[model samples]
Target: MKRCILEGTRIWQGDPEAKDTYVDFKGSFRTEGTGRVFLRISADSNYTVWVNGQVAGFSGCADYPDFRRFDRIELTKFCREENELRITVWHYGIQTQTYLSADGFLLFDIYEGTNLLLKSDRHILSRINPFYRNGYCKSISPQLGCSFFYDATKSETPYQESVEQGPGLAHWREQKPLRLKAPVKAKITPSDKGYFIDLGKETVGFFFLEADSPEEQLLTVFYSERLIGGKVNGRPGWLDFSLEYKAKKGENRYLNTFRRIAGRYLFIECPKGLNIRYAGVCPTDYPLVETHRKFADPLVQKIYDTSVYTLRCCLHEHYEDCPGREQALYAMDSRNQMLCGYFAFRGSAYQRSNLVLISKGLRPDGLLSICFPAGMDYPIPFFSLVYVMQVYEYLSYTKDQSLLPIVRGTLDTIMKTFRSRIEENGLIASFEYPFWNFYEWTDLSHNASQIGRTKEDKTPKQYDLSLNCMYIYVADMYDKMTGEHTETEGMKKAIKEHFFLADKGIYRIDTLHDRYSQLSNSLALLAGLGDRELAKNILTDPDMIPVSLSMTTFLYDGLLKTDSGYRDFILENIKTKYKKMLDAGTTTFWENEDSILDSKAVESLCHGWSALPAYYFHILEA
Candidate 1:
């Protein structure tokens, strides 16, 4: 099938590489009694289409330039004879964990059938948006990108002809469109400087507000995943989850789909006599049709329900590590999310799209980047191996052999990358520089000092237990998938000789470092290096260094492989840990057991990878 012609010239004003800028395009199109019209659009960072000032759609899928995607939205009902079309595109030129630096441009086309009636050209007027203070770009986090200062009192610059680049190139994208869902009606109580509004539970997405003020006032909006002293903990250390909006005299209306926020509470600071019409977040939620799952035990059912909600909050443009902190997709974080998603959502489309997106993350050394569509180089090597397992699981669950071809080269390159790294010692060496050899948030990897170590930190020699075992595990999966041996048996033997501590009956992190972690031992068992009796012994020992919530699946996997009877043990273990969170009145599980994420204020109360019980429910229960 012939794809849509790259007809519309990519157009923008100002330095195409301006760090953080907002540009608006204004044009009018005559419908002329159209049979069926569609708004075909793509942008550098993000865009929102307003047909006569009504939000038609928002967001461009987080992507890279070589592997770009375009959205085709049907506008037959919204379009009229004299229609006004306005699109605002937020261009983020700086490199973040979630975005790659690219020239700011947009390709917009209104087409009826194949013939394009209107296209973005020099005629479509555009200019740097004045309402948003462009140079005052404050970051929410490295992953989520920019937060803006929107001024309703500011004047606008007259739109000019947009400078033309060449034609655009992209394939039509397929995903559920984001919809504005009403949150629970908030209860607003007056505070020292602002009013605290709670949506009653954890929520994800953008903020929208309509209010009437007695006079012109400047209001500061603060939001976060948790509260401090019964108020929103907006600013955590240096990170800012706060934005300022200047309101005019009478009624000020604002709904920014561009600046996204994820939290249950909003702190709006306003003057006296400011009447709030309806001020709360309208979640720009990705559609989740939940499977009606039931559990005989009430606590187990509650755990399953919250786990599903956690998964939903983290799933937006792509699978995020945490919607509050980093709305970026890491391979390992998403592997757990996908495992749970296969059960909760009961469909493979979103997971498949995300897997394909992950496949597009190409690096110079044939290793995938840390996050999808991110331009940074610091990657956790274990996550790349986990990605191999994710693709295999997708095929296993769906019995779909077709995706192998699309990701065949990627899978092959990842294997070759790891295979070449196997040293003369006959074991995979831990990466030293420019890479994070993180397996989990464990002391063995020494991640407790820094969640991800800096370039200066040196990892152990060639006997990293989790690193080698991960390679062996994924290599076996690849070999099984292709029926070609990766000779993992030899590597497994080398791992056993080097890392196994006979006295302790557990595997050490490396030969050089005398450290043992639940994850390293779990990986050893799963990779087929240890005996079943040893697995039973190591996993049951309370003295063993425990893994974090994200690594629970490995422990669970290793235990199940030991014997299916461990299912009861697994359930009880899950209940014991998760029950504490439930008892603490957590609606969504914490990023860590301590509710400590990066800093105290930035605690992600609703994290995605912590939602793995959703997967366990489907697997163990079924």
Candidate 2:
């Protein structure tokens, strides 16, 4: 296949030194007959396109420039003999977990059938947005990416008019159009703060508002995935995702296109006399049809439905971990998401794209980042091993051998990377650096000392049982996927020899720690190091380190894999856990039970990794 490169467009930048900048580009084209118009668009970080002040399209491909994806939007509805198009591109200059920040650039081409209409070049008028100043640092999580501060008082409405001068231009090749779906709106309620809207579910998209005020007022919009104390809490760590809009008197309508806000509830606070005509969310997600899978149990059905909804919310431009806090893609999260998607949504394209995107994120040291298309690099060694498992899963579901060639080098590199890290005891040792040795967020008392440790802690664990077990699992997966075999027998033998506590009939956390976790034991069972009896015992153990929300999927998976008869028990357990979330008024699965721990807050109520019950339901039914 020949790669198509952008010929006429040059990379554009508003300010060379600006960290987080917004650039606006405007161009007009006269159609000869106006039968139909198509636009090919791509931006560095993100972009939204408007035609005659109406949203024509919006997308930001999660990839590097060389392999950048572009959206081919059909503007037939918004087209006329004489038409104007405006594009707003956000260039987040700082490095983050999700976005790979680079120089600001916008590449686009317009066409009326075969004849070219207008292309993004020096001729087009472009300028920096004067109104949108970097306001408060409202980052839900440092990994998600930066938030936007729109000062509507500074200037005119964006996307409503074209600017005179702007940034330079950039060139990019065209890919497939982004999967688009109609935005879903939610119900609104009146409150002292202002209008409170409940999406009835979590989603990732822009906030829509229509209102009228007697006098000029500042409208503050607060977004949250979970409500605390029966109200939306904005202060979660350093994340206060409150966007202020300066509204003129009389009537006004607005949609936040600059930043995609993720939440299930919106608190729109305004001054007195500000009549909110309508307040709702324009929910966005990957284009996937609703699942037809059904269950007799209402609790199980609700869990399955909410799990599917959670997966949908996380399936935006990429498979994000959570739409509210960190709209970043983690290999481990996506692996689970892909598995659930196979049974629920049954889509393969997005799964393939996610796998390829992560494969492209392999660093110089043969390790993939915790997330891809990201600016700053934070590699989780265990996640890299999971990447191998994810690829195998993708192949198992889609049976698409095409991606194998693309990720062949990446697979080999990862295997070699892990192989080099193996200790003398045949187990993969924890790294010396502070590289996020996170397995699961177990209770503090269970594994208190092992929970949070810095690289400076010279105390050497004999071996990481969970990490080595995952390696063994992936090695076998890799061997099965490809023809080549990896010598994982020694690693499996070492896990039993070094980490297994025979007297307790369970696996320890490691040789150094006198503690054990469901995570390590479950991985041991899933990786074939432990038997069904051990798995059953671990599943029923009350004294063991409880499985966190994220690791619950693995625990259940190990249980089901160990003994098919435990299916009913697993299903009932899922109902017991998720019923608590439902009772707590969650429309989707949570990041963890931390939200319920205190009436004050929760991390994320709509996490993708927690959507594993959906997979289990489908797998069990089959």
Candidate 3:
């Protein structure tokens, strides 16, 4: 049955054109002899729920308002004969790459067992927060959402105090229960800057601080996936994630709970004369049971455990590319994450939800965006092909056919769009539309291209061997899964004729570039465009452009397909590369091998896509 919003609550919006807005709401109710008190809470964009000054819960999973999610909390423990409830809703009025922002609103209901108690209405005392200066600052990673500025000098509002109110007037329907798990306490270490708390692993959550100051002071908290030279590198850049709070005199207790910040390390900087009592992170993640699969080798065991932990950090309301930076769901990233989930976790619901979410990103032009449920559209053409392959993989692993019907239309549209672009030679022509043609993060000079600065770079507009091979691979899977014919043979033949250098036993990056890349040739082997001998030579060639950690998953897959004996070699390679991370004291896999990148500040230490080795362990053994 479709859930409806509580009756009489009007959808609230401070300013329709405001990009960011915060609305504080307060309501009070009296309950006598309550067996159990429950609160069904939800809001547009996101919300944090507090009952009588104690943290109750939070809700914000990207979704359309019609299908908005609500969390059910047992408020019995916090409830009293006379009770007060407070909620702060951070409504991003504008959309972004990961969230579909809409009008600001909050819908909630309080029930005593089965008996009705309270529902959100206009009578609920609500006001636009004067403290939060929306649009005052921008986020380091735009996709991660906006930053906030709150002025402590401003007069404090009684937003948390109980108030007599009437009823709200908006209609709503209930959906799935919120998937955000309860927060866990993190481990902390003292540092010169302040104190560093390691959540033991990367996770998406907020910092919890309890301190007291003789005088007013400002506290700054910096977050990062990895430290640089034994210190938190919070410099302003693409990955800069931090927060600020004002500590009042006497007692200061607060939780940076509005945004779900992701990091393994937190550096708290307290002003002089402030007495620090306690500081730690309340780590948040999806409540998925870890698979108890074990390996005899301790190194392999650590790798496997780390991979599982990486996935856990990336799993929340959806599969994020990285918790520290974007926190957006990319088809390519989520595809790898889903494969790892199939082996490392117990259920398929999260994978299915992610697949369906990406499928919803299909545009009118038959192309999917780089991320789903986004406000703005940034299409990575090849990632659309990856979406098809991801569906095939999900079906193969889970044997769940129900998703077919759900994604069938989007799949058909993608095939039709690609088919329309195929030239007479049966290969896709250079993309004419504005789209990202990213394959991997390999050196552009090595691939004979001048465009590699940004992921959205568009240069060397010509037929690409890697993209065509990816298409062939997905087409084959589509044919096998749907019993629908795809022109995989024609694509394979075109790829061979145009890109493969028979005499050199290497495939060109594209028709225009004479350069060879591991990405193109390795994919050729995986798509069966080249033989095992060719794959062997490509794997051994030092002259070939090296693959990035993100693309190494494909390289390994291709190598294993060419020859099963490569398993030992593959395991050794995994150990060699991942050992560097382990030696560096990382509890999770990294976005890239540290040596390949000059700086550790930019690298995500707990990247989900890098967790492919966990999946490989299961497959190689089988």
Q: Per-model C-alpha lDDT, please?
A: 0.81, 0.75, 0.75
Assess candidate 2 and give its TM-score to the true structure.
Answer: 0.91
Residue 218 Cα positional deviation in candidate 1, in Å, after optimal superposition: 2.2
The better-scoring model by TM-score among 1 and 2 is 1
Lowest lDDT block of 10, candidate 1: 444-453
Q: Is candidate 1 or candidate 2 better by lDDT?
A: 1
lDDT (10s digit) by residue, model 3, range 176-294: 33344445566666665567776766666766677777877777788877667777777535555777777677787667567778777778787554566666666676778788798
Candidate 1 vs 3: which has more TM-score = 1
Off by over 4 Å in 1: 1-4, 32-34, 271-273, 446-462, 596-599
TM per candidate comes to: 0.95, 0.91, 0.89
Stretches of candidate 3 off by over 4 Å are 1-10, 29-40, 65-83, 110-115, 150-154, 158-203, 236-239, 445-460, 595-597
Which whole-number lDDT from 0 to 100 does residue 559 have in model 2? Answer: 81
| Poorest stretch of ten by lDDT in candidate 3 | 169-178
- How far off is model 2, as Cα RMSD? 3.5
Q: Kindly give the stretch of ten consecutive residues in candidate 2 with the minimal lDDT sum.
A: 161-170
In candidate 2, what are the lDDT values of residues 197-290, reduced to their tens digit? Answer: 7877666777777778787777778888767677877676667777777777788777876677877778888766567666666655566766
